[model samples]
Target: MYIEQLKNKKYSLGSYIPIPLGFILLMFFNFLMSDGVDTNEVIQQTISMIGVNLTFVVLVGPLAFGLLLVLFWVKFVQGQTLRSLTTSRAKVDWKRIFFSFFLWGTITTAMILVLYYTQPENFVWNFKPEKFFIFLILAIILVPMQTSFEEYLFRAHMMQGIGLATNSRLIPLIVTSVLFGLMHIANPEVGKIGYIIMVYYIGTGFFLGIMTLMDEGLELALGFHAANNLVGALLLTADWTAFQTNSIFKDLSEPSAGFDVLTPVFVIFPILLFIFSKVYNWKNWKEKLTGKLIVTNEIDTVANDSKL
Candidate 1:
């Protein structure tokens, strides 16, 4: 029944036609906003970029996306249900959320510790009580917003629309994952690692997409992303990192796009993925990822034909 419902809401060819155009519009607006900002140096400019990301996060709700799909259904095709729009019918599983949160938090903490061991000098013993508390508070409020916006856009909104349109799991999974990576092209890490880092970003997208599809909801992705960002922002701050917000430990290390990007992509993420797969008992990987999307006429038929 859920699969049938998913099929009913799939988008048409014209459904995502606006996505790229929308990005272009958003970029233009961001450039205009940045024109007069007070960022003078490279570090300042990077902070300014973070500010831009924050602005986008504020504009887009934690689950703001999928509206495009709803619009497509209403304007292009007829008979989309409210459940499809609100995702109310598919219950949000909190257990998945907590599990993802714990899993990512542990993995990320381990990664940070490993990094610290390799380059202790890069970290300035910055465990000041006052600053640490401030970082904690900000994480409590803002970090989740940033992570949620990303998950909602790429993992939730875009994935749902494309899934419905293609009537298949794999196409949407691949497309949304790549787009998610592409969106990060301007990240500071990109400049450091060349395009090779994109593999990691896209890989992460694939990982989250799989979690969402198999789990039958966005709770896992949402929780994982939120926990990842929240911890990253609160636990550490580096001059070279994308988010330089007040953090507990300031990384003074010269930032290079080396093992940092690759390790997470290659080692940490895969381990986490395996852990999740085992914990959730996710099966039929090939089928769930590559399966075709099908939109049934049953729901619509029942509603309309009932009147006859």
Candidate 2:
């Protein structure tokens, strides 16, 4: 139903090519340009030059603008309402969003605390009150923009577009999930921990894609993502991580592509999916996720003939 909303005269799959093509080209160029450079040193130098807060703005601001641009394209170019783009319900569900945000936010914070206590030596107090409060304000505003941009692009825009083209939920899910993972190939974590970290990134894409399809809305995915990034920004920082903010603690441990990278995808995501399925009462698993699309007219005819 959510994907079917894209079935309209104004919606041309061709018009949407430029957005993703541009994104792919950007990532490809970044990989080429940073091929031999010491990316960690580059990140550190940039942070040192501009300070952490400004560096954060420089990194996140464009994605925030990107979120706006995507919305504008959907609204003006595609002639789709923001509500239709977001969900199939009569209106956007703020409660679901808040519930998901609070749930994941709690889990993430608790996990960080457990790690901090278990391996106290690996972490150091990195909080600076003056710098932190400012960073917090900026993060609270900009982090959601960055996260929302990803969600809308992968989960909503591309997912719906691919579903419209292929007429199969499974195809869009797999395609978007893999593309979403590739989108993060240039992240510093990939360099620090090796390509194995891509399992987490791509798995995260699958997790979010499954959420969108199952829930039939982006509220949960949006909330989960925003909380994941926002809470992490406020709670932890690592030199090897993408967001090197003045958080409450800094990780000094050596980064590795180990079981930890796989645990979230293999263990935690499945558990969360179970919890969400129970909470949302999702049904029709084989149909909702893997079924072929039936357009409105066909559905009407089927119902009419069944009654006859």
The C-alpha TM-scores of every prediction are: 0.74, 0.93
Over all chains combined, what TM-score does candidate 1 have?
0.74
Clashes per candidate (backbone, < 3 Å): 8, 0
Which 10 successive residues of model 2 have the least lDDT summed?
Answer: 299-308
Residue 164 Cα positional deviation in candidate 1, in Å, after optimal superposition: 1.5
Off by over 4 Å in 2: 8-10, 297-308
Give a tens-digit lDDT track for model 2, residues 1-308.
67765564457788667777787788788888888776777889999899999988988899989999999988888777898788866677788788889999999999999989999999999999999999999999999999999999999988888888888999989988998898777778878888899899989999999988888889899999999999999999999988889899998999756555888999999999998888887778788789987567432211101110
Model 2 vs truth, CA RMSD:
4.5
Task: Give every collision pair in model 1.
Answer: 7-295, 10-164, 11-164, 11-165, 167-292, 167-293, 168-292, 168-293
Alpha-carbon shift of residue 306 in model 2 (angstroms): 28
Scored by lDDT, model 1 comes in at: 0.62
